[model samples]
Target: MRKWTGGMLILALATVLFLSYNFIGKEPHKQTAYDFFHPSNTSLAMGSSSHAKSQQRIREKPHLIDVQGLDDLYLSLNMSEEESRSLLVWAQMRPLLSRSDALPDTVEGIKEAATAWKELLSVVSDTRNISDDDPGWKDCPHTVTSFNGNLSSNGNILHIPCGLIEDSSITVIGIPDAKQGSFQIQLQSSQVLGEAIPNVILNYAVHLPGDNVTDEPAVIQNTWSNDLGWGKEEICPDHRSNHSIKVDGFVKCNALVIRSSTEVNVNVSHPVNHQSTNNISVGSGHMSVNFPFVEGNAFTATLWAGVEGFHMTVNGRHETSFAYREKFEPWMVNDVKLEGGLQLMSALAKGLPYSGYLTSVLDIEHLKAPPVLKKRILMFIGVFSTGNNFERRMALRRSWMQYDAVRSGNVAVRFFIGLHKNLQVNLELWKEAQAFGDIQLMPFVDYYSLLSLKTISICIMGTKILSAKYVMKTDDDAFVRIDVIISNLKGMVPDGLLYGLISFESSPQRENDNKWYISSEEWAHDSYPPWAHGPGYIISRDIAKFIVQGHQQRDLQFFKLEDVAVGIWVEQFKKQGRKVQYISDEKFYNAGCETNYTLAHYQNPRMVLCLWETLQKEHEPNCCE
Candidate 1:
């Protein structure tokens, strides 16, 4: 009886011991306020994620830190360290115009703030051209990004999804600290400016040390949601508050805790409830400056940690630096934490300076072009039309487009249409599409703002499916000198093809009443990259492929203006080491046709008839002259 009892006791003890070991060692799964948006704080979920895929490559995010008081930093760096520090202080505080007495809350003050922001942005944007020695100078790789964050590992490399990472906020990337000197990270922010108000902080727990100082980070990232105003209680808990006072929900403090590097914008905001602490002591590093923030502006911020401290630059401007808070250690910091509104486009944790390349195959549209055809000077004219614009479509077909050659197997001409909200209009468009087979209607509405999307579909059809050597995107109101254009196509090269009235460095219209009012929300940049004027532009097959691929990768930001969007693609290709040969000659007139005209814009039916008849009578003279 005693022996049996003893055996039972031992077994029970063993079972209890096993249970205790498992229970005591594991951490509980707790969701905090920060975790709702920032999943990077948690263990990386190995399988499928509920979040949508990542949309950026290493460099699509543009726009960087505000250059407030860096006047001498540019024109001349001859200023003393005291002068430099003073300027830096002023630059840091300019964005806090919402709070500072220097910037009173009034229309004049707001206008002044806006102007200051514009000037600061100008410095950051143009600094690269100033000199290689200037901080923040970087050559934009400027290609489309295709790796949406849904990743799969194939033993050797990790594969991501096939869309843009538009919705993702934090992308926590862990870097292997193999060497002590390893400390360089380069990434481009997406071009989408999240909120019109530039009040937010994009915090980076730059050097997340895996040390004995509690694994829980000292601060949660301030993901000031547009829905939630900037409130101090959540982002920087009471335990985290130090310098800036929280007015309403906006949190402001002028101090630094040297944990890492990332741009933090001080803008109008919202709130949350949390604890705070002020245990760490670091002096003189204050937060200031807010520049015009635009989403989808591809800005690059590169952080390099040296033996002294963390040195940083944004798009080639030497932005800021921070010395070691505690001390630099190889085994200390291993991962990067990105918090806030940014679509974390690229994260490079390589401590050593290294090079990497991105190659993508992005195509998403189908056109029923001839599968097999002998080599010919083929060209397709995709005229953007509307359901209500039936008159315009018929007028075009009966006028200049009536050329029998356009109906040939070698050259395909089609009208691209979009659905109207009215069912009758939609049904009529579908019927038209089925009957003519020349009308390609899309699933989207026929709104003028979404022309860029329509253009994407056309390029896909022209380049990937049609196999055309040349394609032209013209408006329904334009008349093309097709007979002359074909003659010129014979001598054109197979690549680097672009022909249009080029627009160079056009300024964004700030006047709201104007048809072209480009709010900072739409595009934050002062001037746009040189783009071809929209009414008509000729693209070679290769250029078409590049443009569509870039858009698919979400590298090309979609603007309301279709021509400007295409121009953005052209600029991106230029950054990618490809060049578009644009013919800015007045003969490729953006307005009504000149006597020597390859194309005529805003042509009515009468104008089209006149143009076709006149060109034919000219004995095939060079219209390009």
Candidate 2:
């Protein structure tokens, strides 16, 4: 019994071993799973209907071929045979197969079987080649051409020629499937021709200088013979590019020369018909020549002569000679001699054929006339007063008053009064008003009164009451050049008008004291009209009368600063349609001791005295001498 049981076990084990070896060693049947699951295969099919459904699902609804992956698969299939083969091999080798160890004979079957083998070899190769220097060869040409196979480094569609493989037979073995689409290609070349040159046409016009004759057009023609032939247009396109066309010729006058033994001053007149209206002077020669040619223009010539009597010939033609027997009168020449001489030349050259070296001469006289003279007078003189003291100011005043009494001159002068006395008076008033609770009114009243008094005093005394053309009022300490002031005023502004040193308003600040302030009531107006400051300024005769008359109507009040008061009064007059002109050049109260100032104010007494002396020596030298 034991032996029989052991034999059965041994036979069963041997049978299992034989079946396993055959299954492992034999090539897989060429039939795919679909053949076994087909509805027509009944012997091996149990639940064949269900199996058919499973096979349909695997073929028609493949889960492995998702939308994204199917796109790549389709693109691979559409590639060239070599490219398709390469892709299929790469995809198959990416994942190992369970059943096949050897490749298949058919293209599709071979690709499927080779996938597992290729994947294994690729893993081993990648692992062996990996190193610190290359980091697994991330930027390898294989991968770059795979995913971005159609794109260049600059992100443009790449156009690769199959012919390039002849030189370098490199192939990308593994790659991501390419996107499927219709691609466009554009080819271009890199050579160009230069721009063509253009044709140019030049037009020219000519004129004669110092002659009022209108130019007459002259046609210049050139004809070339076959022997001296000009080249064709193509050969000499720019033939006249730098060539100049010059017209040169001469005009002749049949003039007669007069000769005498003594220095007989003779005047010869041509008949009206043969007269050359253009005048030419005779200077100890057979003919007086005049060349009337402009630069690049036409030329003309005139002829005359001075002598007692002489014969003249033009181009080998003879003219009659004359003799001066009586004393010559320049106004009345011998008409019979003149007519005979002109007629002889006209008859000789009436139709004669001649050219080259044409010359002529005529008798003429040098007539002398008396010289004429022109006179100039002092049309206008502007006076500006200088000197500070009441006596000196009066002297200037009296001198001007007398000068006006004689010549009625226009004058303007200014006076400089120190602000110390006014400031002292203002302080006293402020102290007095403070005791009465009127301190706020003190500053306004003192400043307003002080300004009004200074301006009104000048208007009354400094200007001519009625006769002056213009009057300028300026400070006594100012250095002024009356001549320069008059000349500049005559050139720039000639009218009798008031002028001033102008100022524009900027930020308001008081440097005298922190307590000083200006109320809104003081500068309520949006803008101040232009007016002259009293330090140095001008007043026209008409406006001077208005200001003087305005003061007469009421007693003039005082203001601390004369300029501000003048601005206020001028503003009043401006409202009445009278305007003040601002003079920017005439600097007023320029704060320098040695500058060439038009006017300098508030200077030291010693400097002012020295300036007066220097100006008298420099400008009034005649008076000092």
- Each candidate's number of clashing pairs is 58, 27
| Most accurate candidate by TM-score | 1
**Residue 317 displacement (Å), model 2:** 99
* TM-score, cand. 1: 0.40
Cα shift from native, residue 496, model 1 (Å): 1.9
What lDDT does the true structure give each of the candidates? 0.45, 0.29
Error of 2 at 51 (Å): 98
lDDT of 1 by residue, 89-168 (tens): 12222222222111111223233224433343354345354343445432112122232231212101111111111111
Candidate 2 positional error at 564, Å = 2.5
How many clashes would you count in candidate 1? 58
Return the TM-score for each candidate structure.
0.40, 0.28
Question: Per-residue lDDT tens digits of candidate 2, residues 502-541?
Answer: 6545222243221122233333345444555555666655
Window of ten residues with lowest summed lDDT in model 2: 198-207
Estimate candidate 2's alpha-carbon lDDT, on a 0 to 1 scale.
0.29
Number of colliding residue pairs in model 2: 27
Top model by lDDT, which number? 1
